[model samples]
Target: MLAEQTIAPDHPVFAGHFPAHPVVPGALLLDWACHSLGAGQSAASREARFPRSCGPGSRLVLRAEPGKEPPSSARRFAITTEDAGTEVAVVTGTLGPLSTAAGT
Candidate 1:
């Protein structure tokens, strides 16, 4: 599945991150990636690396893919932003099992 988020210039974090030139925080981006996977899901192990800064007004897309290992519930995801058809920031990570429903 693919999830998308738009970076708003008025986001509260930007105020303290920088007043003159605001940029999206890497942690915030990771949070978005996790949220995209599932609200209740947790990552057992993961890795994330940012190649470029994502400024306000940027549109990000997160794509989820199944892991290569067999019989594993883990999933891998990639978060990216594009500019003039070129990929910008890329956040990658893995997700743990989804939380089961009550009584299940």
Candidate 2:
């Protein structure tokens, strides 16, 4: 899966993170990756690494790639992002058991 997002300059988090030079928080980026990958139904266990700082108004492209394996209750996904050709962040982890109910 691929997703795109932009951190607006007026976003509230920037004010407290830094009044002078604002950057998007890593936690928020991780949350975005989870949502983009539709992992809400599963208990996702992941770690994120930020190699570059992303400031306000930066356009980010997120990509989620599945591991080379068949589907199962636990699944691995590699999530990464880039902004204007520069790599920004990467997250890798496994999703917990899949839900059988609808709309999970």
- Those runs of model 2 whose alpha carbons end farther than 4 Å from true positions after fitting are 69-104
- Provide backbone clash counts, one per model: 0, 0
Question: Weakest 10 consecutive residues, lDDT, candidate 1?
Answer: 95-104
Candidate number of the best TM-score: 1
Off by over 4 Å in 1: 39-41, 97-104
TM-score of each: 0.76, 0.65
lDDT of 2 by residue, 51-77 (tens): 577777877777655644434444455
Put down candidate 1 lDDT per residue, 1-104, tens digits, no spaces: 38888889788999988878898887787777666666444543355566777788888888888767632556777778888988865666665554411212
> Best by lDDT, which number?
1
State each model's CA lDDT, in order: 0.70, 0.62
Per-residue error (Å), model 1, residue 60: 0.6
